[model samples]
Target chain A: MGQPKQERAVQTRSALVRAAAEVFDEYGYAGAGINRILKRAGLTAGALYFHFGSKEGLAEAVMNAGQDTVEPLLESRGLQRLVDVTLVWAHRLGVDPLLRAGVELSLGHEDFADGAPFESRRELMAGYLREARDLGELREGVDPEVVARFVVGACTGIQLYSRQVDGRASLPQRVKEMWDCLLPGIAAPGTAQDFDTGVARGERLGRMGAQA
Target chain B: MGQPKQERAVQTRSALVRAAAEVFDEYGYAGAGINRILKRAGLTAGALYFHFGSKEGLAEAVMNAGQDTVEPLLESRGLQRLVDVTLVWAHRLGVDPLLRAGVELSLGHEDFADGAPFESRRELMAGYLREARDLGELREGVDPEVVARFVVGACTGIQLYSRQVDGRASLPQRVKEMWDCLLPGIAAPGTAQDFDTGVARGERLGRMGAQA
Candidate 1:
């Protein structure tokens, strides 16, 4: 329990989460064996037990960390900010193991330590949609909470399909097309015309986010 | 083969497919055991191999059959028919084990027979959208293929979320909400005004499709 020992335990826990995320991302929860996770972390059984009681515990820890890693970027306002958040998240999915694995785990239909692994993503996006509504950025008929749920489902599905199809090489375009297909219905007339849905927008935003 | 033997083989194959679908649906591809599939079918290894070469082969057969079970619901015209197709399919996802198992396999992120399990569904929806475009049923500036892909992704993700959160009992409403959010952007002006996206529509159409 000394300061140095405590620091080392924290580092060890982080490593375990990262390694578990990789294995889960690649092989899924059912396929990700505890033996493989231990081997990947280079930790002994005693050490793993001290940190996480079981595979389910490890998965929950990873999900919590991944959700934190995906905290919304920038302090910008309006519906464009919502679009930016989604696009940047998509770009990050291909590059960030924690996130990619977190998403994989979320879709597995399991209950994580933090209620549902994806509940935060849904709530956060819903908050943004509510803001957009308050600002008159949304179309007259659109319901912010309902539209927010659509966004969550759409992004989740897009990423799942992209991963299954091609390791997400086409995610940027798919994200853009998703917006292109959706904005016309929900955005205030003519306001979404200038918003960037291109791959480049996400790449740039993601890069900025990492530095920030 | 003799005529009676061929008929028996056909019966055995149908039985195997049904049993495999149930196993695969409940346990996923990786978790589905060959022993369990055989036990469920009440068949020997020789009988299984005679129809499907291996577990992979069996999964492929299940996926192909699932896709077929999901054939477009109505031959009606316009975007409303597109809406009907989506709604009917959502209702079926809960009631049909084959479709459910096939979807589980497709989302398993593996290579099954024919190609990726979801490719044909996307292509078929895209084909429908193209026809809608040619018939002037699409809104100006909307791209049919792009919308089709969104539809596929949205539906896939919604079904997944619904399954995890509520055993897919909420699928009909989710599908309805999905269309409510997307149609304003894609449907022809004044055309989507009266389309029914309620669960009742799906239930009614699904019953009709079954009777037909």
Candidate 2:
């Protein structure tokens, strides 16, 4: 009975964090009221306080949760992996209502006195770039750290613009364009030709499959 | 006397808008109260209301004002200009207490019934891409609209990341990387070689000038 109660408490905390993420994304941190968060979670002030000491604490938890979700996606992919994961995640994180809540949490920490959660993501990207270089995927004379930051920066730009605008540009198309522009610079000299050829072949195969 | 009063009123309205922009950026839209904006502008409700009918009205004015400021810069430089101007504008927009406030007002309008103000900026970029295509600056088989959106998207990403984190990657460096990646894909074939040569010559000329 006690174990079930503890599990329920954990579930409640998770629900609260998730609710808080949505509210924060929609209304921003300073604009979001604790009462609203508690109300949405269907919990009392005590439960809220127990899980997160204050609003700032809640904001941090939301960000931590988001980082937990995205960090692993970053680690598993190669350079191409980053593009694939981002395209999948962008739909969820950049477009889907539930996941889009994480965007607010990430942007809201701009006012934090300590440091923002994005720092960890940036470091993770830089580390991945270093690994990619060691694996000889990156071009000669390319600074892995610089390229990492650039890649991350480009992804950030796609998400921000996609979220703000109406039905002007599709997210997937935007991602493809960014990747196309970006690959030529960081790619080992002839690698771009190979990738382009593969993309063309893949399109042809897909077309033939669709016809059949 | 009436003309001078109108002029003074214009100046006062401008001052109030500037002050509101600062407050909105720092505290965000919902968090920023009309009283705070008035206090910052050294004015009262009557004065503010005289210029702008309501808080929403004031936000519109701020967005319109920002568009006026930003459009000319874009027009003069063309869409392909490097991130220098964009970065300068972003740093100002992010850090300036006044401009930051305006940014929040602009961003918060996502929920507004009408629409956000920066919509035209996207159109402007798309138009620039079309013009670039006619001029043979863009590569064959590339979608100019997609490329334009991609460039803008990349810029937004760099701005958001640079502002959120403290790191060795300066805004300019990140912008440069984005351009370096983008130009190769979009530039006319062999244009990358021309760019590299131009950069080399520019550096040599600078060194010779310094020695002389």
Candidate 3:
């Protein structure tokens, strides 16, 4: 294919993935069909199959296609970075289809094993927690790996409930409240004071989010 | 028409519901079939239909048939009740088919509107939190309703992940870890010290479980 066609194909694939995410996020994997996705993307059947051979393939791409909606707040690191990452992700969970769909697809699908990156996120959290512990930031007797998994689970439960109750309009606030309630136990005394455990804090970081 | 026949009918219905929960928990509502549930229950199609008219009805019954595996810890109350309730529920989520199935059914089904008693659980938690606040057990400026909902969401996410990763064998520890991280932010200063916040705490509570 020519250069223009190659570019067009890529754009079409991206569009389909985005559209598929929206459909799957709303209807889940079982209910999501190629027809609705194509309709949403304003493309033809040939376009979808050309990019993703099947609905499962499209879902797999969507599941793995996590992109940072905004660049991190440069000032944050360690335990604070973990908090910022979650808060920002919560905010985006309200507005971002790809991320939200990945969560929905992962939790709702019964047999789809490659659905959610449960481990990758856990590892990322553990790494930050370890740094926090090493730097004398974390409270004594906390296991980074255990707490990381616990955090991931809590976030998962919160998002699922939030989505069910209100389409996640309240997620950022809920996440902030979560941090407000949780950080005191995990962070060393007086260490969590510097962190702003508020939805506004996350939204500010989101607005300041720049492409990496 | 006889009493013995009615009692036998009750036994069969209980067996069918248990079998259905296991199946629904494994395959979800969309994937669960009447044939498999019947096989698990060792009943005929007629027996299943006689007890639960449809798969949807069976799922609804499974979701509503929640039973607490442990009595509330007597040593815990106020802010501690919130911790015990969550931890106890977490331990049960690992062992109790009814509760675990309820979690699975509620999270997996899309548009199964009469699903998971998420609001009910939040209300229950909020009610407890309100008492905690009235007793001066909660931190200053904390809203029970908001915190209750947030706690529910966090638990929902954690349980979903736990079920997927392990047969929820780590649920008690995970729930305890969650309490360790959260209580500091919600409870009054030094109030959380009374709570054990450990897997053994949940296990001990489980041992004293009684039918209410």
Candidate 4:
């Protein structure tokens, strides 16, 4: 018996997203071609149009899909949770084509300026840093807003460097190093020892994500 | 009397580099075209071929040109010098087209992986941090190599964020903020007060560059 139509449609949509992601990852947004994406997906142009409507639509789908990975970490809080978020996201950025493409598009494409999550990510980080401050995990005089922006920028630079240096294979390790250098500046005295800045921390989260 | 052949050739080469920088800045490396670059420069194909040989060759010229802006910072030393380097470069990256294009090309072009200055920039930063370590300007436990890599990544991230969020008009200010957040982490307790993280520190350097 054939798969149900709804189930088959869902599969097709996912397959198209994956294929588009690979193309975007390799060629970037301006260079990516719809024909190439369709060929990779082994789907008709009609299917792509029916699902994503346009190449821009498909690109937006890939960008949005990258955010779905964040759902699993919502249970955690404070500075350690912030570290977990960066670590897990770095690990996924190394392994996931959709996330990688989303980052490339978000960072480099001027037309998609509003779509980039620099503001939202900074706000999320600020929220976590606020929690850390309330819990007395942060050092005195450290502003959550300021520190949040710095962390966002630092994580971005680390990933960009790792990506260029070794295709992001070292992102988690670099992020670990970043936290090591930064934690002492932001965390309260004696509290710096409480947070784990290990690559395994991210790997464990990845495993948890898979199990769920 | 006409200009010397050498002087004319030099002018042609610099003009071509500037025009190419503008094109690459807007369209990126892959999206950039030789014809468009030639049009922007108002030069024929033969002139481009004579000067830079190929598009890739021209890109190398642009990348190398970005390093020219660093020459002025070499006379300073230790932690303050390291801060100066980032601040000055951030200021340049905000206003200079050649430097801006060089960074854009260096960060995003996969084929140019070996060409990106990730390792070299990190090494240069390490060298400065080593000077800081020798001068006892760093915190006792802070490793220069680790801190160097982190600083490079953080500066890169700060510049990238500044570029995306506001076209880098605020880069020097952001760099100062970065040093404000980071100095406590790396510098010795009494030494963080010695370094200047002001935007004026960079603007003064920019003015000196112009005068020179």
Question: lDDT per residue, candidate 1, A132-182, as tens digits?
Answer: 899888988898878877788788787777777787898889999998988
Colliding residue pairs in candidate 2: A156-B157, A157-B157, B21-B98, B22-B97, B22-B98, B24-B101, B25-B100, B25-B101
Highest lDDT against the true fold, candidate: 4
Per-candidate iRMSD: 2.7, 3.0, 2.3, 1.7
Give the higher-lDDT candidate: 3 or 4: 4
Candidate 1 regions with alpha-carbon error over 4 angstroms? A1-5, A26-42, A68-73, A109-115, B1-3, B68-73, B109-115
- Tens-place lDDT per residue, model 2, B22-99, is 777767777779999999999999988888999888877776666424334332233343333344454344334554
DockQ of predicted candidate 1: 0.53
State each model's CA lDDT, in order.
0.79, 0.61, 0.78, 0.83
| Candidate with better lDDT, 1 vs 3 | 1
Instruction: Please compute DockQ, using alpha carbons, for every candidate against the native two-chain complex.
Output: 0.53, 0.43, 0.61, 0.61
Candidate 3 lDDT score at position B125: 87
What are the per-residue Cα lDDT tens digits for candidate 3 across A1-212?
A: 55798788888888998899999877768778889999999999998777888888888889877556563344777888889888889877776779888877676665565324787789888988998888888888778887898888888878777777777877787788777777777888777677777787777777666343
For candidate 1, give the lDDT of residue A91: 85
Q: Which portions of model 3 show Cα errors greater than 4 Å?
A: A1-6, A42-50, A72-75, A114-116, A133-136, A208-212, B1-9, B42-52, B72-75, B114-116, B133-137, B210-212
lDDT of 2 by residue, A1-212 (tens): 35688799889988899788778877767778999888888888898888888888887777667643433423344565455445555444533434555556565445452334455556766776677677787777777677667767777667666666644235555666676766666777657544432333223332332244
Q: Is candidate 2 or candidate 3 better by DockQ?
A: 3
Residues B34-144, model 1: lDDT tens digits: 899999999998988988988888887887778544245476655776787888889888788988888877776456522355577778788778888888888898877
Output the lDDT of residue B211, model 4. 62
Q: Lowest-lDDT window of 10 residues in candidate 2 chain B?
A: B197-206
TM-score of chain A of 4: 0.91
In model 3, the number of clashes is: 7
Q: Would candidate 3 be rated incorrect, acceptable, medium or high by CAPRI criteria?
A: medium
